[model samples]
Target: MSNIIQRIEAFSQLGQFLSQFTTERISKKEQVLHNDLFFDAFKMQVERAQEFNGWFTLDNVLFSCEGWSKSLTNENLNKFIDSINIKKNTPKTIAIIMAGNIPLVGFHDFLSVLLMGNSVVVKQSSNDKHLLPILAKYLEYIEPSLKGQITFTEEKLENFDAVIATGSNNTARYFDYYFGKYPSIIRKNRNSIAILTGNETDDELNGLADDIFRYFGLGCRSVSKLFIPKGYNFDKLFNAVFKYKDIINNAKYANNYDYNKAVYLMSLFDLLENGFLMLKEDTSYASPIASLFYEYYDDSNSLKEKINSDKEKIQCVVGNGFIDNEIAFGQTQLPTLLDFADGVNTLEFLNNL
Candidate 1:
């Protein structure tokens, strides 16, 4: 059996391997173990992922790789591991149902299960099926004892003690019905929001633009709605976010922008647009692609109370000390290992199981 030290070292090495594929460039380093065998293969997989899923552009995939590389360091992994208690018991198999909204979105769950000395059976989203398997192969190569511990399947899952599933609200209902008897963590629809005061500087607003536009605003961590002062100026935000105006060049994104704009205009709805993005006054949390929704808040106390009331529907609150547990302006998409989704402690759940 592989001990905790070996597991952590293997993951740390995997992090080192991922460091080569950042958004700046994909350079090969001779120091990386097995690079002669795996580097070119992984690079091809990245390109293949972009070709298969239109939303998975090459740069966005590299950005995801960059975030994971920064997160999977020796210091960070050790800190996360030391925070939890691992028992010496027989290992069990954990089933993971992943979401494909962004590249490698479900990797944290996969890492949690394996690091806790449990085997994993993963059912990947078709939209993201190309990347993780190759990485898993690399892990097995680095740690031979990890063989036979990981499995990927397309068939119905069976013989698993617990499950971690993420999907939309409708699929969550089915997962609840099927996996209810087992110890499970079932995640449903959730969106992130931002609270803006008129006092934001240009740099902070630019970071806010990243929170809204990265991954084309598809991830749950992406800010889809805003709570602003009653008489806020939109010009500051528009000017800051104009740096991302090139996003309109992507055909899929442009199609959504044009279609949604047409619908809003035909319905005679009031809107503010700057040719690339649109701002609509909506109370809903989930906004369409290329559109942002905003609401007016009269007082901070009432806004905080309302947010607390709707905490379950919210994933991140990007602000500058406006509330407890708020994320900084541009840090939503660059979550660390400890930033568990839905505010649930995945390691704690695995430990108890």
Candidate 2:
């Protein structure tokens, strides 16, 4: 088999192994590669992931795993990398500094670097330290040639040809100062928003709920704010998303809800609530946990222009025909391989390097 084909097959096998752990729970499937060797161990890793990071609930962890399983199919893999040439040469080392906001949050960058025929040195966030390493081990065992291409470090990174770092606005400056000389992709805080036209169906609004509450609104693609027509009532939205009211049962989410609600009440900020989510009027793109910010739009055209002008602060805009290349409502988290983060093509960047 060719080098790239072997690598791709390794990833595909990893995806099939991960598909067993879905939103339901982790289960062992017969005939999977390495199932006899690693199945029990990986299940333990899933539990360990949540124990290390309270935000990495089993459901969310499995959700992330399922998404990758679907994306790593042969067809999707071919489509994502076919346009970008990767030669079998001495590959450069790409150091990646990953965020821990959600489960397997940095896998795409890791996958990108590997698919570009480069070695990766990863520094993972302490909050998300367990799962990816186990998956990497599975990959190495599947394709022995990949044995030395992946490395994980807890110490400071060194001796890398390029870098890709994801962090908050504050950490981004630090990365820029440190990695400015290297060919790098340093991502800062970016939040998604939903544009409501007062004509959305109940199902669409429910889908929007998935976008908002999937990762407890921690992902860059999570909708933190909303743009609604002037004088539009939020009753329908609240009703549509009410089915997700069980989210309040989670202690962390409940604490955030109670705390933010108390703060809003103490400060006399006028807001809307539905026993779980709080909607406050604000202009910010990034909202706090358990709270969503909203703004009034007088004209759709003007709103489109505003969103266009502030594209850097935005990630995915969820709406129907609201703007060019807008993400459909509720599909923000279901990003395809071609849906590169920050609209920057990672393969192209690695090829150039």
Candidate 3:
């Protein structure tokens, strides 16, 4: 019991350490010098969080880890070191296919590999390759230990023990076929949701927009759907979001919104066809197109039935207004220090291997 207490303490300290990494390693001004991919990703994260003035809060960072670690057991912790597989000594490589959305989507995968005690071979997302390394300077301050383990590459993957790839439903098939034989985890298209009690004031409703639109609706963990009590009028919801119109006012978002809205309207008349879609709502948690943030539903009696029915499609649910065991979208995966793949808890798996 005392050992468990100490282990928990270590995680708490590690959480604090990592929180500082987000704030200290990342900079707003120096962000301009990053690759364009990271520049836009960071901008979206900062601006949407309304922390544009503050960058990332150490509090949020620690909160994310705490949220993720809720399910870890003392038994799991005891076996963590045994579950991870790493080649001993120099140049042992692990391949990772990173997510493009959100700031430092790659960082999740990078952190997994680092914590698992392996060298990383990263396939930087072409869409987001521009901005993630802004932390190279900050990481230098926090952990000189990482300086040796990190390596970037565009080269063909070769000579690696494990591969971790994240992509859409389509790309996942290819990942399964090509990377299947090797030890791997291939992530498919996942959508997140939020359960609403409809008790929120205008202020909380508006804040919900941050969970929905923080990364321009690109993150897998962002609220992708909403479930609400019956007969909830959208007027109140729209009023809340309308307050954040300044964000929609941004040229890029406005253009995308207009483009998606046009496609949606056109689709109503069967006038246009292509890679476009628009979803309607009284108060949805989902955005349309390449990403979904949130959605709303009125069915109460059948709520759990509906969710369980679509369980295969739904990846995570952010149940607001719930107590005790309520978990959010980002918290779906119980990540340990070594759950290096698609949020799988690898330490437990490799320990037996």
- Identify the candidate with maximal lDDT: 1
User: TM-scores of the models, in the given order?
Assistant: 0.99, 0.97, 0.64
Reference-based TM-score, model 2: 0.97
lDDT per model vs. reference: 0.93, 0.90, 0.52
Task: Report the candidate with higher TM-score, 1 versus 2.
Answer: 1
**Model 3 segments beyond 4 Å from truth?**
1-92, 133-148, 269-286, 289-301, 321-343, 349-353
Candidate 2 per-residue lDDT, tens place, 1-353, comes to 22777778888888899988888767788879988878888888887666788788888988998899899888888888897776555689999999999999999999988877789999999999889999999998898888888999999899999999999999999999999999999999999999998999988999999999998999999999999888888999999889889989888999999999999999999989988999999999888999999999998888989999999999999999878889998899999999999999998888888
- Root-mean-square deviation of every model: 0.8, 1.3, 8.8
Cα deviation at 275, candidate 2, in Å, is: 1.7
Ordered from best to worst lDDT, the candidate numbers read 1, 2, 3
Q: Residue 53 in candidate 1 has what lDDT?
A: 89
Q: Write the per-residue lDDT of candidate 1 for residues 32-133, one digit (tens) a residue.
A: 999988999999989777688889999999999889999888899989988887666678899999999899999999998888889999999998999999
Per-residue lDDT tens digits for candidate 3, residues 20-97, read: 223234433432222333434533443344233122233343334233334233444445544545444333467888
